[model samples]
Target: MHTRALVLFSGGQDSTTCLADALTRFERVETIGFDYGQRHHVELAQRGVVLREWRARFPAWAARLGDDHVLDVGVLGRVSETSLTRDMAFRMEAGGLPNTFVPGRNLLFLTLAAALAYRRGLTVLVTGVCETDYSGYPDCRDDTMKALQVALSLGMDQRLLIDTPLMWLDKAATWQLAHDLGQRADPAGGGDALVQLIVEHTHTCYAGDRTQRHAWGYGCGACPACDLRAAGWARWRGERGAG
Candidate 1:
């Protein structure tokens, strides 16, 4: 069993969920975030808030929580003109991908994450990349993750297992996963606490609009990130109500 893990956390709902999952699965779990000069840099700020909430509310996971590292990869934003990194309006490109799809963004993140994991003696690398309910970013696909896993292991000469707990799960299921994880950590009120932490503190905004409030979370409520999160939350809550 891989004892230690490093999650590629972005302080978004997805990554935040992955972090919670990691804290439960691994004996020790660390987090790594990237500052790619994206338009929604606010997520970086929100990362701390999520961590603090979890530490204060969930003692079980807090005991397992390790260090958090944020790397400044501003070069990615400098080179890419995508809507996520720039102030431009969002649109679909003729090549059949969203303008927010930053080429090689996930790849670079995993590469850097693997390097950090190697130095830190972490064997498992967890990411929130999901093709199920995400933009049509090729890098978010399962194949890309598998290939990167092999490549990272071969390149680093270490057994680095890439874990994608959200690969097959939709946004609602992702939310449910967090709920379940929280319950395991703190059975009394952990489920609601974790879900509340995500809805109130985490971010999934493409435009980084924290002013607007929504049931799902904080976002512009218009970007693809917010749309997925909102729709997922509605579906999950709707089903929850029906059940």
Candidate 2:
């Protein structure tokens, strides 16, 4: 029932899709991005570009978008030795978690987001966390988020709705959702506006390479993030063909 939402956006495919979905469902949407000294911090720049493009493409919806916020949690990088925040090589942990997993990253993000939302009088928090086609990050799990939501509510003493539109969706299904959102936002009343915005403006590469452009987007194709995105794109294409 909340009309306003704050999204934890990363300027990646999943988060970007979540943002578009938020625009359609909420009267007001704001985004918060973090600068935790991650190697792929270039996505922060892409976040600005994506917001600007969305504003230009759909003025009505864009008007509803609140200012994008970037928090400097770089201290996390100093304290955490994860591949995402440090120069260490990426690998899997003994229990099967990726080395890129920054302990309590999502927890801190959601707590910060909830604080912001409370101050802004927003009642909903949307995130792009997906269990279907994502690294084995325990924080991305629905149960974890739900537990955090309850904890946040108890701590803040206010009701906050946490929405995860892509929780049950695979990467290909996510791509399709983005496409569907684009069609809904198209000024012509039917086109790929959302998908186009995602491909041209968003950044998902963990390597933070802006020079290497592909059919999917800019990325160092060899990185795990890029590989996952490419695989999703391929599956999406195949599904389209089959349909």
Candidate 3:
């Protein structure tokens, strides 16, 4: 029997790259997305389209896979105090923790994902939490992931592997991996594809602003997320130009 994986997908650049990465490693791949009442509902809608496109583009893989699941794990919605789920007015920070942090959001999502994986009899779960690019978030670190994996195993009495392919990699490296996987083509597109995808298709703005475009994407550009994305894109584009 070949390895099977369940991906925690959000249709963002990192998660989509992880999806492509899962394709190379698993015999079958299925995705699970959670709607935790994000400030930006447009992203949730875009996730549906992206998943549909992926299924259409990879029918053979889809045939071997189990049904992709999307659930409303909106328990956090009621209790979420972060700007990501609340109406709290916040300003984008430079290098500090932003209001976009949904308290215990990843923990809840992965807990649900683990339960779903156990129910599906899958021992492996893939996530795209890049610590290098966004370590300011408490949940995106390796320690939190490992602790969750351990807790899930202890709680469920079954061993599970949480794979983080982009855990240590930076934005440029992630773009490179997506390119290597043929999910992206051209250096120009390669450098900015993730940014564009993140901007237009996925929503990272805490304000939920769908209007206007920034250097990084459709963001305030002052937010931590946009700043990191912009810096990475600029660096990658400069390198591409020089080469």
Best by TM-score: 1
lDDT of 3 by residue, 93-155 (tens): 565777777778888888889899888888788999877888378898999999999999899
In order of appearance, the predictions have TM-scores of: 0.98, 0.96, 0.83
For model 2, where is the 10-residue window of minimal lDDT? Answer: 185-194
List the candidate 3 regions with Cα displacement exceeding 4 Å.
56-66, 91-96, 183-200, 213-217
| lDDT against the true structure, each candidate | 0.91, 0.88, 0.73
lDDT for position 194 in model 1: 91
Candidate 2 segments exceeding 4 Å error:
187-191
Compare the candidates by lDDT and give the number of the best one: 1
What value of lDDT does candidate 1 attain over all alpha carbons?
A: 0.91
TM-score of 2: 0.96
**Reference-based lDDT, residue 39, model 2:** 95
Q: What is the C-alpha lDDT profile of model 1 across 172-198, one tens digit per residue?
A: 899899899888888898898999999
Ranking by TM-score: 1, 2, 3
